[model samples]
Target: MNRRTDETRPARSKGREEALDHFVATVAKIDEVLGAIKAANDEHYGTHPDEVHWGHAGDAGRVLAGLKEVLDIIEGE
Candidate 1:
């Protein structure tokens, strides 16, 4: 005989859905930063590549790094 048990049950709560929504929002924000970085890098590379340095890229890099960490946390959980 085959029967289902509690061990094979699925989560029935709004918490998971809420978490997914939050993750999607966070990812969207990260995408926005990526877009900004691409735009800034393109403009700088085309007009002032020499002026682009660690100081200029630092903020965007930091944001991307933070987003990566958040994504890792979500995936880990």
Candidate 2:
């Protein structure tokens, strides 16, 4: 008995292939951004402790919150 499912099915249209390709590319871009963020974080945002300010803290806080929201959605929270 053969059962067809998402894994066994092929993309059947040019538009679908394009959409899947775009989704894959967008995920790749997100991965690249995460890598950059990690590197910057390791460098302490390229600043001395005394040089850090409220504006920088706010920027980092916003990014952190955005990432948390994405995680929450993905985790079905």
Candidate 3:
């Protein structure tokens, strides 16, 4: 089955565009937050990250992996 783009579709609810817009905005926000986190991580841990400084690498890795999955879905890929 073929699906038309929003521009070709008749007038309807704004949900699709709104969702896409939200996704774009959310991605930007995520980038901003992640940037700050990386900055803090680099500042505190320097080159070698220890278990004591910054965060537990394993925990952060798990959370980031989950977030990447969700983001991939939201990005339609």
Candidate 4:
């Protein structure tokens, strides 16, 4: 159908602009999180042989599961 007219174009463009701004902010936040994860990994944040325990494993498992879900969505899986 020919429902969209010139009048709607500006509204759609503004919506797109707002969506893109949100997307950029989200990506920046994700990047910041990834950097934090990398730093934690580099420092072995909770993996010390004497300090590690079942709780650490559980925490890692949950983090991995969450990351896997994000990766699956990013991969269009």
Off by over 4 Å in 3: 1-13, 45-77
* Pairs of residues clashing in candidate 1: none
TM-score of every prediction relative to native: 0.47, 0.68, 0.45, 0.85
lDDT on C-alpha atoms for all candidate structures: 0.74, 0.88, 0.73, 0.90
Best by TM-score: 4
Task: Please report how far candidate 1 places residue 55 from its true position, in Å.
Answer: 6.1
Q: CA lDDT of 45 in candidate 4?
A: 72
Candidate RMSDs in Å, in order, are 6.6, 5.5, 6.4, 1.6
Least lDDT summed over 10 consecutive residues: which range in candidate 4? Answer: 40-49
Query: Model 2, stretches more than 4 Å misplaced?
Result: 1-12
lDDT of 2 at 5: 81
What overall lDDT, based on C-alpha atoms, would model 1 receive against the true structure? Answer: 0.74
Give model 2 RMSD, 1 decimal.
Answer: 5.5
Highest lDDT, which number? 4
Instruction: Compose the digit string of candidate 3's lDDT tens values, residues 1-77.
Output: 89878886644447687888999999899899889878966675344444344456665677679779988998998
Q: Rank the candidates by TM-score, best first.
A: 4, 2, 1, 3
Candidate 2 lDDT score at position 26: 98
lDDT of 1 by residue, 1-77 (tens): 99877655555346677789999999899889889868866676354666677876786578678878977997995
Clash pairs, model 2 backbone: none
1-77 per-residue lDDT for model 4 (tens digits): 66898999999999999999999999999999999998987877757779988998888888889999999999999
Clash count per candidate = 0, 0, 0, 0
